[model samples]
Target: MSEKFKITITTTLTLVEQFQSTLSSSQTNAGQRPNPSTNEQNKDLDPLALLSASATALKSHVTKLSLLTLTSPFTASAVATTLSTLNASVLPSLVTAALLVTPDSHTAAFQSEIRVLTNTALKELFFLVREIQAVAEAKASKKSLDQSEKDTVTLAAGRVWDACDVVIDVATKGVVGFVVRRAEEYRDLVRDAVEEIEEWDPDEDGDEFFDELLDDDNEDRPTSGDSDDDDEDSEEAAAALRARKKDTLRVLKPIAQIYPAIITNRLKLVPVPLVPSDVKVLESLMRNLQQIPEHIDEVAGALYEEDLQKYTSQVGKTKDCASRAINLVVLPWAAKQSSGDQETVGDKFTTWSKTWIKVMGEVSKSIDKT
Candidate 1:
C-alpha cells in the first residue's frame, strides 16, 4: 500500500475513535446540565438552525461516502474530514442546543428527542465510516469488492442518510412545531380509539376479548353468562351490559372529541417568550392530555369484556385527566391576568374550561349511577 493511503487510514480511524468517545459523553450528559444564562451574544445563536445546518452537512458527507469506489484513494481522507467536522462542530452545537433547552421543562422532552435522533444519525455515520474503512482496506490488499461487501456499504450509507434526514426534519420544525405535531399525533390516537371502541363487537370477536385479557392479567375473566345461570339472569346481565356500553360511549366520545380542541386552545394561550413556570404548566398540560387516550383504550377494553367495575374506573381516570388538563390551562391563564382585567381577559378560557369540567362532572355522576 502507498504511504499516503496508510497515513489516511490511520488518521481516519483515529478521528472516528475520538468522535465516538465525544458522542458517548454528550449522550451521557444530555438534558442533565444546567442551562446557561442567555446574553445578547447568545441571542444570535439559534440552536435549531445550527442543528439543521449540522445535520444537513453530515448528510452531504454521508452521500459522498456512499458514492466512494472501493479502490478510491480519497476514502480515508474523506471519512476523516467528516469525523473532524462531527467532533469539532456538529456535536458541540448539539450539546449546546440540548443544554439551552434542558432548563425549560416544556422543551426538555423535545430537546431529548432531538438528541436521540442526532445520536442515532451519529451512530449510523460511525458505522458507515467503519464500513468504508473495511472497503478501503480490502482494496489496499488487492481484493475486488464482492456483492456482499458492496451491499453492506450501501445499506449502512442508506441508514445514515435516513437517520440524518430525521434529525434535519425535526430540527427544522423547532420546539413549538414539534409540540404541535406531537399533539396532533395524540389527537389522532384519540380519534382512532374512539372509532375502534364505537365499532367494537364483543359477540363477533369473543375470542379477542379473552385473549387480550389473558395477555394483560394472566387470568381469565367472565366473557358471558355462566353455565349455571338461568335464562332470566342472563337476560338481566345482557341488559346491564348494554346500559354500561351506552353510558361509556356517550361520555367518552365527546370527551375524546373535546380533548383535541382543548389542546389547540391551550397552544394558543401559551405565553410568548414563556417563563420557566409557564413551561412547567404547559408541560404538565400536555402530559395530562397525552394520557387521555391511554385511559380511553383501557375503558374500551373494559367495555368489551362488560367489566363494569373496570369500565367505571377507567372512565373516572379519563375524566380526571381531562379535568386536570383543563385546570392546567385555565389556572395559568387566570394567574397571568390583572385584578382589574382578570374577569374580562380570562373570561373566554374560564368559560371554556368550566363548560368542559361541568360536562365531565355530570357524565361522571351519571356513570356512577349506572
Candidate 2:
C-alpha cells in the first residue's frame, strides 16, 4: 500500500508541474512581441518590420498552444486568455495603418517590404482567429472543465472572435477602397485623354484636304451641272476622313493601354480571405477590368484599321460579356444563402461595371470613327 501511494503522488506532482509550466508560458507570451531582430539598422528604416516580426512570434505561440491543448485540456484557458489579450492589443492597429497607406506613396524597395509585412500580418491574424475558435470548441467538450468554467471559456472565445471580425472588416475595406479609388482615377485619366484627342483636328484637316486633294483651281464649283468637280470634292473629303482616323488611332492606343494596367496592379494589392461577397464582386470586377486591355489590343492590331466597324461590334460583344458576368455570376452570388443582408449588390457591383462598359463603348466608338 505504501509503494502504490508513492507512485500516485509522483504522477500527480508531474502533471501539476506540466500544467504550471504551460500556464506560465501563456502568461509570458501574452506580453511578448512576435519576434525581435538584432540588426537595428534594418528596423530603423522599416518601422513595420518589428510589428510584423512580433505577429509571427505571437502566431507561433498560439499555434503551439492550439496543438498542446488537444491533450492537455487545462491549457485551453491559457490559450483563450492569450488570444483575447492579442485581439485587444496594438498589433491589429499597426496592421490596419500599414494597409491603409497606398503602395505608390512609398519607394519601390519599401513598397515590396511593406507588402510582405502586410501579407504576413494578415495571415497571422487569420491563423489566430482559427486557433481561438478551436480553443472554444475544445473547452466546450473538455471533461476537466466544470459547467461554469466551460461557459466562461465559451464567452471569452466569443468576444475574441468578435474582435477578430472587426479587425478583418476594417482591413478589407481599407485595402479594397484604396484599390477602387485608384482604378477610378485611372478611368478619369483615360476619359480626359480621349476627350483631348477628339477635340484635336475636329474637321480632319478640312483645309489641307481642299488644298492637296481637290483641284486647286476649283475652289468653288459651278452650281450648274458640273458633275466631275463635285465627285472630285467628295473623294477628297473621304480621303481626309480616313487620314484623320489613322492619326487618331496612333495617338490614343498608348493612352488606352494605361487604364487597365494600372487597375490590374492596384487590384492585385488587395489582401486575401476577403468577405465572400467582396471576393465575388472584386473577382468579377477584375475580370471585366482586364477585358479593357484585351479589347484595346484588338483595336490596336494591324487589321483593326482596315475594318474599324468589325472591332466596334467586338466592343459591343465585350460589353455583353461584362453584363452576363454580372447577371450570371455576381448577382447570383450576392443573392446566395451566404450573402446575408447586403442588398445593395447592384450598386456595389453591377452599376460599377455598367459604368465601365459605357466608358469602353464610348472609347470604341471614338476609335471606330477613326
Candidate 3:
C-alpha cells in the first residue's frame, strides 16, 4: 500500500513536470511570459503591484482596485508595482481610473456598452500590460511557480472562463436523443390531428349502429332516455367518437413502429462483478478524467479520493471514464499480444476504450496509477 502511494506521487510529479515543460516551451515560442518568471517576481515584491496597475490613459476605461483587492497575481507589492509599471509603459497619464477590479473599468461614454466594453476594453488592457516590466523586479518569485503551478492556474482559468455554453443531446439513441424523440412525446404532439379526425369517425360508426337499430329479425328495440338526443345528431356524436378512436390509433401508429427499435437497441451495461471498494475506487478515478484537459491537481485529487459526484456532469461530456483504466489502456494493450485475425473480447474493449479515451486524459492517467 505504501509503495503504491509512493509510486502514485512520483508518477504525478513526473507528469506534471512533463506538462509544464511543454507549456513553458510553447509560451516561449509564442513570445508570451512564462508564469514561473512572474512567480519569482511575486516572491520578492508584492502581489498587489501586478494586479492593480495605474491605468493613466486607459484609466478612463479602467476600474480602480482598492489596496486590499489589488494584490499581485502572486502578491500585493507585485500587484502595485506591476500596475505602476504598466501605466508608465502604455497609455497616456490622462486616460483616467475607475478604481475597481476587472475588465469592469471603462470611460463614461461606454458605460452602457456591456458587450463592447468588456471585450474591447480587455483587448486594450492587454496591449498596455504587454509593455510593462512589472514582472522583472522580483527575482525570487520568477523561479518558484514551476510547471505544475502554471498548469493548474491555466487549467482552472480555462474551466471558469470557457465552460460549455449549451447542453444538447444529438448522439444517436443515447439518453439525450431518446428523451427528445420518445414515443410518448410523439403521441402528445398529434392531439390536434386526432380531434380533426374524430368528426369523420362518427359517420363510420353510424353505419354499424344502423345495422343494429333496424334488425329485421327482432321487433323489439332497446330504447331508454332521450331518444331525440339519440337521433341523427347523436349518430354524428357516435361517428365523432369512432373517428376519435381512429385518430388516436393513427397518431400512435408511428410509435408502435418505433417501439420495437427502441427495445432492440436500448443501451445496456455489462455488469462487471467487483468488490464494492474496487468499484468505488474505479468510479473515483473516472471522475478525475472528466476534469482532464483543464484543471489538474484539484481534479486529480478528487478522482484519487473516489469522489464520484464531482465529475458526474463532466463525465457525461465524454466516454472516457467508462473505459478509464483496465478497460481501455491495459486491456487494449494486452489484446494486441494475442495472435489472431479477429480480436477477442479484450480487443473489443480496447477498441472501445480508444474511441473515447482522448476525451478523458486526466482520468486515464489516474487509472494507470491505480
List candidate 2 segments past 4 Å from native: 1-174, 200-202, 206-273, 293-306, 321-334, 337-370
Model 1 misplaced regions, further than 4 Å: 1-44, 68-83, 95-99, 103-106, 143-148, 201-229, 268-273, 331-342, 347-350
Q: What lDDT does each candidate get?
A: 0.69, 0.45, 0.32
Candidate order, lDDT descending: 1, 2, 3
CA shift at 205, candidate 1, in angstroms? 9.1
| Model 2, span 1-370: residue lDDT tens | 1343334333433432443344334334433332334223333333334344444444454445445444444454455455444444534434434432222332222233344444444444444445445445555665554555445444544443444444344334444554465456546654564555455442443467666666667678566567777768867866765565555455454445444543444344444334445454555554554454455445334232446566555545444544543443333332544545445533344445455556655655554564
Q: Which candidate is the best by lDDT?
A: 1
Tens digits of per-residue lDDT for model 3, 1-370: 1343334333433432443344334433433333665445444432122212322223422232212122234343433443453345422211111111111121111111222222333343443232122222232346344445344334432332221110111111222233224333433433333333343333333366777657665676547654565686667765644543443333223322322232222212212222333334333433333233233222323333435444333333223333342342234222334564434434443444454345345433433332
Name the candidate that leads on TM-score.
1
Q: Rank by TM-score, descending?
A: 1, 2, 3
Better of 1 and 3 by TM-score: 1
Candidate 3 runs further than 4 Å off: 1-231, 250-260, 263-370
Q: Report per-prediction Cα RMSD to one decimal.
A: 6.0, 21.4, 25.0
Expressed as tens digits, the lDDT of each residue in 177-280 for candidate 1 is 76777778878998898888767654353478786877689555444574346556766777776667667777876677666666566665566455777777
Provide TM-scores for the models: 0.78, 0.32, 0.18
> Residue 357 in candidate 3 has what lDDT?
45
Give the count of colliding residue pairs in each prediction.
0, 2, 55
